[model samples]
Target: MNISPNGINIDEALEALAACTVWYPDYREAMRIITKCINTTRHRKDPSSAMLIGPTGVGKTRLCRMIEKDLGPTQQARNSECDKKTWPCVYIELPESATIRNLSVVMAQVLGGKPTDNQSVVILEDFIIQRLVTIEAKLVILDDFHHVAEKGLTKTKSSLCNWIIKLLNRSGVAFLISGSSSAEETIDLVEELSDRFPYRAKLQPLPMADKASTSVLLGVLASLEKEMIKLGHLKEYAHLTDPTPYKAIYLATRGNFRRLSDLLHDSFEIALLRGDYTLKISDFAEAAADLAFCCCPNYFLMSHSQLNFALKFQTNKSSETAKK
Candidate 1:
């Protein structure tokens, strides 16, 4: 069994790789939007709300967690008096079958109270509003806001949106909604609801045709490589600067952050299992195959000869860089 020069074995490398965190430009943009929304809504009568719309695996939930962390203690309160505390933000996810009652129950629970099953929707709503006021919650983040539209609950979804709008107006707290593109449809069902969330931040996948997108992709790869080095992986992974592996990776994952991360993770695992100190282009090819990376034309049309050429080119580049 071959171990890394840094004394990290296969199991250790896999664990370290799985725990790596990579931040990108879009994540920063989302954080900015969240902070701006929270600050802008403070002490305002008509608190503004914003929607974060993106496809699945675009880091919407992760962005929300980042914002929550930056704001302050999410599960803790600032002051304690008679068991009441000031919560600056309340984060909750919409139930699978979203309704006013479900929303209220979740809100109340997060606000430090448990509602009984017999509690009416009206009572639950009152309790939620009162708690928000009591805690001075400046922001309310509802993740997976699109769930309201699931299970043929169009009417209920519209009603829930309106109800949330009313809560925003009444509590004067900004609501940051993170959900898929389908969430737009739910919000559109209500005219006033749509107007309330005029500001929308969208997270998009990397596009191969766009120069800026390619730059971002390279930056992400560079950051990941740096993190990998920090994890005691002394071997060079020069995929970021190498054009061959760079293009192949982009084509394989289509610039989706989660997919890209998974591809790199899987490749690292394969290399470790094969007793290789460095990642190879063939490792990436195998990982992409396991991940079903056949959506892009470049990947589908790629031949074995092309892959071999890329592997050889990347190897040569890595060796040249090592000598320098």
Candidate 2:
């Protein structure tokens, strides 16, 4: 395997990139809002919930995970600490094809109960509610809630809305549901459910043209360079904020956080192979070709290599579709 001048290998450099998290202002604000949501709903008789909307891979799950970590993981999903049973938080991901019955079973199981298919939905839900009270659950997070907006899930959505309201009313346990844009529309369809989810936050792609957003993008890249330096993989500063490369990266990733990370990750692989710590537009351009976001209309301004790779990728994809 190829190695850089500092003897760093591709695996090591890529691992460093993965270890680093590029925090933007919006993500920090969302964290504060969720912290407020937990505290405000803990004492209310009729607890209200919060909803977070963003495209997939926008770090909604990561935010929920930080909430879980702060609350502390429950032992055995429920345990006595200081002579009181407590489960500070619970996180459940809604399957793409979720149903009320299955959701009830999942809740029951998470609360430390053994639920079977044979049990009635009412029985499972009752078990969950009682268990929630016993464990003193403060907040429950349901991710991928956009699935409810899909066609023919009307009955399941109604059932879930009623069930969540019941849990909030009985136990004063707030909820945080997150999904893509469709999750917002689904909430609007149900007036009662929508009312309960008045606290809403959105995650949007960073803008490249704007001065402030561009600064944020550059800052994130600078932080990554620092991380690499601290890891001893970089001896020289990688001036990624420079226009030529930064503009190419912005075009390739469209300011999406996940795609930005991925593009850098792939570029680092090329850097390692070439025994270089500094990145180039050619690296990100080639990396863009390998990404699955071929549907995007925007194209990076680079040599034919990027465009050619994209064209080849599209052709292969079309051929595969024809065969299928």
lDDT of 1 at 26: 73
TM-score for each model? 0.79, 0.80
Estimate the lDDT of model 2: 0.72
lDDT of 1 by residue, 1-324 (tens): 547544567666667776565666677776777777776776455677888998877778777876776677734434455555677778898888767788788888887788999999878778888888887787789999878755456776777777887787777778888888888778778888887776688998765432544487777777787766555454755455466666777666767878877877877777666653576666776776767653333442366468556546756886899999
State the displacement of the C-alpha of residue 283, model 2, in Å, after optimal TM-score superposition.
3.4
- What's each prediction's clash count? 0, 0
The 0-to-1 C-alpha lDDT of every candidate, in the order given, reads 0.72, 0.72
- Measure candidate 2: CA RMSD: 6.5
Best by TM-score: 2
TM-score of 2: 0.80
